[model samples]
Target: MNNSRLISLLGISTLRAAPRDVHLLYLSRFLRTAAFGSTGVILAVFLSGLGHSDVRVGLFMTLTLVGDVFLSLVLTNWADHFGRRRTTILGCSLMITSGLVFAIASNYWILLAAAVLGVISPSGNEIGPFRAVEEGMLACLSANYDMSDIFAWHIVAGTLGVSFGTFSTGWITAIFQKPVGWTEQESYRVIFIVYTIIGIIKLLVALKLSNASEVSRPTVERQQDAEQEEAQPMLQSEETSVAKGPGPTALMRAVRIFVPELTAPTRSILWKLCLLFAIDSFASGMVAFTLLSFYLHSRFQAPMSLLSSLLAIPFIFSAASSLLASPISKRLGLLPTMALTHLPSAILLGFLPLAPTIELACVLLILRAALSTMDQGPRAVFLSQVVRPEERTKVMGVVNTIKTLSQSAGPTVTGSMAQAGNFGAVFVIGGVLKAGYDLALVGLWLSRRALAEHDDIVLPNVNDNLAENEGESDGTSRV
Candidate 1:
């Protein structure tokens, strides 16, 4: 089979399938996210065990973000042309390779190499074609599916993956503790095994899809054929109208298609939201690695079992919260919901360190969980409303790359702060930063005046463009 057909064999398609297709895609995403979850919980632990300093760990994660910058810039542009599915498969393969590298590496350089190859700049979150093509493909699949609802479902699956991986990794560590003579650091090697296993499954899923379902014919052929069949006089008139004005060059049109400008009101709102997201991510990143791990070890002297169970709580809450996002968005408006949830979560994160007991900590953690994830779906909806549809992938790519970089930096900063015996400082700083983020959102909502009521808007170019823009089917203009 030719390359395009081979890609379709792997589930990349031009003509969107039914909602059933998304279900399969969602399943793949869930699995992918679950594998990713293990890395989030374990990477800090692993690096610290290797006697790496907080700054070094931070630098290590930064590499991933840096790598993502170059990689995503190129890949997203490529995805606009080649199918998202094909590119996603390639990214997944890289993730698996990274996992194997982590499994064998003992020194800092090896870990750094692994981060470069596997963890740092990876698209574990956004690499999939399913997401890149989501709006277009879903619109093609069924009118019943709401973009908001789909995003909510996506977040739910993500939380589920995170919970499963985090909990499982902790359990795996505890189970192997005695048999493997587990030192705290040594236990981390097991996490790599889990990562590898997840990667392999994702690879298999990608390779098994059919490519014939994805490729479509060129658009020019259809236009030419249509012209040949039209009434002669009418065709001549249409040709005359077309010839009267010069068409835009492909490159100029593509630039406009990919990067859209936000209106004056929307611009300020989006900037504030972006700042909020950045702060929230930064704080979340800062303490994410140190908080749970330290809490479990320091307060309760608990084994892996308890930590695993605690890790599961946020996922449970997030799953529940996602189902309610759409209604909440409808009821409260996207901006309000986004800000409200995040502000409260920031408060909760700040207070988490004050819990006097493990049960209290866990409860606070659960509360934090619900509040933190509640805004995810709404935030996505908020973005879609403000920006042109075609620019979503590029915007998301840029934003995601920044988030990844912040996350990488978070661990190092938090780790260093904690190492200095000011563990509480991490939570305090993170919470304050998150609160600032929430407050900024408030300003965004106030600044924008022409904010429309929550009505559904659909784009027609979504379906045909998915294939055509990807250079898979030549019928449409390139993105």
Candidate 2:
């Protein structure tokens, strides 16, 4: 074919092959993340403005993260069973409710309750069950496409939303507070109002997603195939004749559905992944975006508007790096890509506290942001590949829960340190811990790869033995 025709065919193929649900999920992520980014940048400052102490602000952030952990664990465990589309809609609804409560309520107790029960973002990232469930659904729908590429675009969408929201919140507050004669608190509340409106739009988009977005459970046909395979015994003739027992009680069955049943190999890999992710998340919590915003204000007496603008720089670079993830992972492989890209960012974080000036610190942070998130897409793809298809929801849920739980400790610690006049220590310690996590992750990945290779070799030998036994049984029947 001519070059023109060939190029046209490739373009059409790329666009047409991606499922509609994938696009809708991208939009949902963008809208939700935009809301998160806006609130995340100002949450700590907003609380402080309301006469809350730094410790209280930190505690609020911690509780918000902890709440997400619990809710995500419950919702994501049953996401497949409950329907991905429906669960996502529900999550969005919670987000809208959280925004409304934050916007209208001045009672500290009521605000805390809203934060705990509803979807709220303190990390300038995904805050509830949406990410895990959406990722699981994307993996299902994008089975026929380049999964890494799709995930990269998904990250890009989220990061862009965050960038825009972070940048706009500063201006939004400035616009409302100055010319419009709104109170500082009221200015911040305006962002939450926009957050609620975005949530409504996201919910509408989520509703448009088709049922094909749901996780594919094993059908009766698949069950029958499994039964036939089990019945074809090589040497265990008596085993096939055993009558099937009665089904488990309904209560027991319900419990079983919530618990993930993975093979030994898959479980081991999952555990290793969870441990590494927890370590990284804990480090991340120490300098979560909200706390970071607070730190800048307290340490440098930086204006809220400047802090917001500076924070947006890193997100822009992070979004750009996300676009490179797919091509880089294609060449370097998933594990190496994640380790190489993430280690540099962690090391850069170590330099953040040492910067001589605010400008230098911003540059360091922007650089860190560029490299830090390059692992996200690869990590998501890796997890999807490592587990059985049926267990993706459970695995993602468990992993995210562990990560969130680990992260919940960070804000509290950092907040206390800030109150104690030890803000530098928080950055130094978090950087050290994150660097350690990067090294450990590489080691774990190598070990898992070695184990997988060993299993690959051992499986064939066992299969050979089973085949020989079957031949012997055939000969005996002929005799």
Best by TM-score: 2
Alpha carbon lDDT at 440, candidate 2: 89
lDDT of 1 by residue, 1-479 (tens): 89876433322332234355556556666777777676666665566668777567666665665565455555554453465557667777777788788877788887777666554322223332234344333322323335566666667777787788777878787767877777766677777777888777876776654442132334324433443453233333546547865333333335533333323343444554556567777776776643456545555766666776776777788777776766677666776787887788788878877878778888888888887888876665555444433344444554554555566567667556766776776787888998888887777665542232233322122112222233332222111
The lDDT of each candidate is: 0.59, 0.79
Candidate 2 residue lDDT tens string, 1-479: 89765533323344356888888888889888888899999998889989998788888889988988888988887777778888888898898899999999988888888988898888988878888988888777776676777788889889999988999999999999889999889999999899999999999999899978875555223423443454345223444334433323333445544454444556766777788889899999999988887777777887778888988989999998887877777777787888889998988888787887778889999999999999998888877765555566777888889899999999999888988998888988888999898898788667756776876522111001112111221111000
Model 1 lowest lDDT segment of ten: 457-466
Which stretches in model 1 have alpha-carbon errors above 4 Å? 1-18, 120-144, 179-187, 208-272, 289-291, 294-300, 450-479
Model 1, residue 422: distance off in Å is: 1.6
